[model samples]
Target: MSFSQFGDKFTQHSGISRLMEDMGEGLRTSGTIMLGGGNPAQIPAMNDYFNQLLMQMHQDGQLSEALCNYDGPRGKALLLDALAKMLREELGWPLTAQNIALTNGSQSAFFYLFNLFAGRRADGSKKRVLFPLAPEYLGYADAGLEEDLFVSAKPNIELLPEGQFKYHVDFDHLPLNDDVGLICVSRPTNPTGNVITDDELLQLDALAQQHGVPLLIDNAYGVPFPGIIFSEARPLWNPNTILCMSLSKLGLPGARCGIIVADESTITAIGNMNGIISLAPGSIGPAIANEMIVRGDLLRLSQEVIKPFYQAKVSETIAILRRYLPEDRCLIHKPEGAIFLWLWFRDLPISTETLYQRLKARGVLMVPGHFFFPGLEHEWPHTHQCMRMNYVPDAEKIERAVQILAEELEAAFKN
Candidate 1:
């Protein structure tokens, strides 16, 4: 059994693949406490809205039209127009329908964008994607088709009061050189949930502009839509900036729709790739989202419902960690906006990868931190000392999971 370079590279045991596999396996196994992966919490209000929307769509014939018709490579027209109008009117972004394009999902959008900008080039010189911050999304680790497609700068860890820490982009030492092709960072970042400050974002934007490269923001958990951010963050996009959003966080992961707002040229490029690939992004998510925007319900739901749910979850989860885990030995990343809480065990005897296996044996699941630091060059012990835990599970499950986690940490330190 032989495979091509693409097949071999993708088939390799990758971090994203392992995270997804564990999530699926945990789903199948009973009594599993699922605190791993990036799955959004299923909020009842959101679910009810979706159910009603589906029913209405069915009644209005929108459901059948979306199912049976094939949209252009860019995506369904109504959704694009709705998004463009919403963002333009609300945020005053210089956007039109031409600026937007849809992909099968953000994962595929990233695969297309990363490979488009980074990797081998025409003139024999290769380019790499620069993650100004190291502890980025694990899914991005394998998105590139070529090996060594990324380079990252170590973050400045700010130890805050009350046993919490935050990761700040080390802007002074960020390696934005000629060889770097694109700049990217996730807001309310995936594993850590640290939202880079507005100042930091402006700095990155300035750097990207200076370097003549486009800035790609993975806003899956950021402003105006999912509205998961706990701290202050202004939505930013320009001709040079590519903002990627998703309906997945808005309680439609199965819909498989990803929205990209960029310059017309970039949108066209994405649309061309879409034609070559999935032929067009799925219409279900777009169909639902279009109505949400036009009816002026998206922002209201995000702000009044989804935001508060995650905020309460963060506060409760932090309190549980404080009560169960050793105060002196554990430090949490300041929960900003995302569903995940990052925990760093001080001087643990074993790496988080080993701890993950022990927790799995007890029917608890979490993502080890090492996977998050994809393009980091040096060996940093801090990476292994950390783990990402999601608060999407029920209250009883969360409490039980924390208890088991505390016990395992105590045992590991003793060993």
Candidate 2:
């Protein structure tokens, strides 16, 4: 039976699910030391907090009622207020409950924002969404496709061969048109783990304002990085700037709580769209998050407990890579904050795909670069020389994986 035509945008796109499924199948069959996926290995404070919450809810007779009730789409008011204050104090983005909308996670916020601003034109022309060529996250493209939005990647931000992995946005080369709906940038970028500078953010803000387009900043990995702080809430340079954040990378994915902060007008529009899409997130989710924020324990824990732990692990992983991989053979980005390293192979004989299969055969798994740019084979340079490896796995697993990767690289070069 033929499936009905999905919207044309979706027809041309391969969603994250397909990439994940393929990776999962490889992992199941090959049993390689898995390093490809960005799943965090750190335990979140919320795990213990949730247990305490369960006891309290049970005693208060609120557990069953919460499970049965349909929460309002705007989210729990208390949580929204707390999130706004947290943004003000933590990231310095001036916002309020009116500027915030709670969602299942940052991914939900991403989809909601895309649906709100990325609808089809009456003339059937596709709207455009811009992102960095070497974007750290894959969600931007995935969300854009579902809305039938065209994705345009800028050239890899030029950086010295031996300098930090950070790239600068060359605003001149970007596709700027009335049809461009949004520009998505991740602070403390995903794979490279470098934070976009404030100057860069200001420039992005200006461009978005100039073009009457929205700038979406994904701050999923902002907190743990040094020299990066959101200390005040200034209005986004453009009225169109939309900020999406998550507690997932902050050690709370199961809480399934995230916040979207935009101007009042944008927030109202998002709330309306959210109502149509997801009625409301679980009430308990927000309530628990609210308590975490209000008590200030969450921030303290992130600063004192979680950040240091992950930072040490990241440092150790980088050192291992430096020790094991020859400098001339593999280029490793020194990540400032976040759990990943973007490894670019130099003079490697095998394609990244072949390397991935070989590493998997040896019980080590890593994400090949192709999965990150599924549909743009024509635009990108053809070099299967890159992969994203997460260092947040178990210490023993990380050591084993790196050893296996080093061995594979040597073998590939020999062949």
RMSD values for the candidates in order, in angstroms, are 0.8, 3.6
Go through the candidates in order and give each one's C-alpha lDDT.
Answer: 0.91, 0.68
TM-score of 2: 0.86
Q: Best by lDDT, which number?
A: 1
| Alpha-carbon lDDT of model 1 | 0.91
Which 10 successive residues of model 2 have the least lDDT summed?
225-234
Model 1 lDDT-worst window of ten = 320-329
lDDT of 2 by residue, 337-367 (tens): 6678878785777788898878767767787
Give lDDT tens digits, candidate 1, residues 1-415: 8999989998999888888899999999999999997889899999998899889999999999999988999999999998999998889998899999999889899999999999889998889999998789998999998999999989999999999988999988988889999999999799899999999999999989999999999999888989999998987898999999998998888999899999999999999999999888888888889989877999999999999999998899888888898658899999998889999997899999999999999999998999999888899998999999998788889999999999998898787
Most TM-score-accurate candidate: 1
- Please give the distance, in angstroms, between residue 361's alpha carbon in candidate 2 and its true position after superposition: 2.0
TM per candidate comes to: 0.99, 0.86
